[model samples]
Target: MHWQGCDVAFLTQHGKQHLVGPPIEAALGCRILHTEGYDTDKLGTFTHELARPGSQMDAAREKARIGMALTGSSIGIASEGSFGPDPVGGFVPWNTEVLLWIDQKQDLEITGWAHGHAQSLQKPIQSLQELELFALEAKFPEHRLTMRPSHEDHPAIIKGIHNVPSLMEAFERCRSQSNNGLVYVENDLRAFCNPTRQNIIRNAASDLIQKLQSLCPACDAPGFWVDRRIPGLRCRVCGRKTRLPISEVWHCQICKMQEERAIHTKALADPARCDHCNP
Candidate 1:
């Protein structure tokens, strides 16, 4: 209970405090000082208006830093989310959420991550009927949408279309303004707009809570979790090593302590995963 009754700053404009704040407060007995003093959209936006400058981790760190500065708190937390194709299948849409916790008092930084299927969709529509179909597939109303004239990058964009009437209005307006009679529609990725992404953010918060609770055996500092996986699992058939991890390396950031623990799921990797045998 290192963080019991501690105050931490959290900066977000998309209502992420509701999704990320409670669990940490409940678990660590910390107070979440939510603030929207700065427009986080300036860092990056899902509508492509402003491109995120750095890597996902960098963005989250910057956000936490800003929150700490704004609230003048020693500790801060923030969450960032990205959407793309799933890594394994490369076909289904995927969402990855990262939650960063920075403790200036202890000079410790910990991150939590979660990834899963995302209800994200985009398409060009020429008529209201097509817009309806796309909305259905995009999980409209439940998950809000953004519309732009002609293409996704168009500057004339309408966002937060929650209901059918607003959706129709945005479609017609964009369609009329489009040079090619097409309106680009996509699921609004803001945490408040998209419930699917919100759920992923919640999971990321849960991960952060777990990491925060795992105290280091050496220094009694939090966030003593697996840092990396060692890959050298032997192939079951050929006895050759594969890319699969044979053990995990747990490290404590505060004390710089390390421990290697063997994975016991399977003694040998599958033959199909062996590079030499498969190739």
Candidate 2:
């Protein structure tokens, strides 16, 4: 309580602290306080019930503020994640996990994120064989499943399908309840349920740790780091610019100071990536 940034209030309903807290605690040497009073689902839910407003970072900030207010801690932490199809061409889905840190006394807000392939699989099931296939691909048992009568807006829904027999029962019951004789089975995206997402959150926490380790040279405030990347890497062959970062702009978190540093003077953009050469 004496140190302004030593205690962090973590806001989570689905056990995110367990996944992300260890790395942060190790990196910052701070006590992690999990807030139990806040309704995290009220902000938004994976089931699509309460539509989340604002950008992911905005939601994360709100969550952190709520936790700090409830716990009377100057430091607050929260995470927001989104799952969907891979931006690059791929059959499997992807997850973007973002971890946010807010230090009120230091006036610092830092975000770290990890994005890549995700194991969040979901599909409409009609047959036992199909269900088994889906489960196999989704890493069943390791990753829990959820069932609903339909994709959305169905009263009869079975959640937290962990075991084989329970999954079997839920599939049959939900399929029968569906108007189309089909059940929507999705990988439980909750942090407690999905190990893949848990790992992603851990990665994001590591990113935050790296960013927080840096202090502003001018003001000595934490979270002083790269603010922007300048892209104008010139091709070696024709000397035309390509959309690759040539310099990084560093800024102070507390003091209004900025410095731009050029990267790797010896390196040049390959002709393959140059728009004029490739196009």
Candidate 3:
């Protein structure tokens, strides 16, 4: 009955385990039971119809819980993603992905993540010209998009648009539903639709593999890793404390054991990162 003897449960209905599951299996050297049939959109959706409740991490945890409940497995895994303007490139897209691992008997919960560049697009349109622009900008036909009248909850919302004919048809239909004649178009941020997001999910899986394989120095638990950061590296020029990580605090998810070690090769922060030195 215990899932410990068996493989881990990875909850996904979107055929995502194929893209993100390889690292986990390769690292853990266990079978991955891909559990499905859960309507995770009820927890939250990127298209924003039902408005995902709580944090992104909460949604992922719930998914893992559901997978474990459905399959009677003690170990479960799940992932979630968020998209927005790129932090480094200004208007370009960025994805924040999280992969979570849960074990009931061991009472262990750990998260691995990736927060960086992604190919995502969103636009609000009033005309055919604008839609075409959005399509090109989003790298459409490849990435695809979803269309809705006023909101994601719009009854006439069209999703999974792949071709120009379908795009034109959906736009005309959705435009009619809107009072202002504008349709909201966004890259379908779902795993099944977007490769960029899937790539990020894979990176998150890799991150989890690192944590899962890492044994705690104290108790030899698998989930021992950096739990937090200690900021305030001294500025090289000004010698004032700068907001850069000076150390990594490693902790065990199960034992709650904590350890802190210096993260940087040098003790001082770069002048560019120092507020007083640069600003």
Candidate 4:
């Protein structure tokens, strides 16, 4: 077997293999082994009730590490996701998917990363009459909706309400118990429940596969990838220094060597972007 061809174990309980495994195998020319009955929720979950064990990066790394430890494979992979309003700046919802690739043989870790904006539904609804408006906006039945009382006094929160009958029951259930007599309805973004999220996961998997195919110029590591940014982009109009990334800092996880290359040519930001010039 090629050094990089060792099998990679994936730690997930949600059948993520349906979305994450095939492309990785094709790209890295390796096999994917899944850990059955592995409760990833112990590490963390989508619901805020169960706190994640660590930072997103840490959680992903540990998940991979545990898989490697259990399977006795030097290589392991895992994916983690964060969903909410845009992390940078936008009104739309965004999903950040992170894939961790770890090689214990070389003590190397590289991440395949992707982020995208998705049309997600999040609004409060008091009755079944209100769902019609949200259904149109969210494209209901295709994209599932979740529900919980607007004023949650107990742990029994309604989740994964897809159909109209189920949604009505959940809304009324919450309304009867809630002090506010309202329900918080939003999109159910679980990949299995939501098709839009599944597509994004597939896209992230493809990006990870591409990263595995890359080789570092410094040490020739198979998963050589970008780790940081070199900031200083010129604004397109004013030609002043703005805080945009000028280059991507690529590195070899095994060797710790670095390479910096500009993603584009502009060296400074336009005065329009500069606070001193614009403000």
Best by TM-score: 1
Worst 10-residue stretch by lDDT in candidate 3? 1-10
Q: Poorest 10 consecutive residues of model 2 by lDDT?
A: 1-10
Query: Could you give the C-alpha RMSD of every candidate to the true structure, in order shown?
Result: 1.0, 2.1, 2.7, 2.9
Mind giving the per-residue lDDT tens digits that candidate 1 earns over 195-272? 999999999999988899999999999999999999999999999989999999999999999999999999898999
Off by over 4 Å in 4: 1-5, 150-154, 232-242, 264-269, 274-276
List pairs with backbone clashes in candidate 3. 44-52
Candidate 3: count of backbone clashes, pairs at least 3 residues apart or interchain: 1
Angstrom error of the Cα, residue 138, model 4: value is: 2.8
Return the TM-score for candidate 3, rounded to 2 decimals.
Answer: 0.89
Better of 1 and 3 by TM-score: 1
Q: What lDDT tens digits, residue by residue, belong to model 2 across residues 61-148?
A: 9999999999999889999999888887866688999999998887788888899788787798788999999999989999998888
RMSD of 2: 2.1
Per-prediction TM-score to the true structure, in the order listed: 0.98, 0.94, 0.89, 0.84
Superposed by TM-score, candidate 2 places the C-alpha of residue 97 at a distance from the truth, in angstroms, of: 1.0
lDDT of 4: 0.75
Alpha carbon deviation, residue 215, candidate 1 (Å): 1.2
- Per-residue CA lDDT of model 4 for 1-279, tens digit only, reads 233466888887766787888777665678888985467778865645577867889999888988888787888888888887887676778888888888777776767777787646777777667867887788787887777776433456777777889877877787777667677777776666777777777887887777777788877777777889876776666665567788898877667788887786555576766765678
lDDT of 4 at 2: 35
Steric clash pairs (candidate 2): none
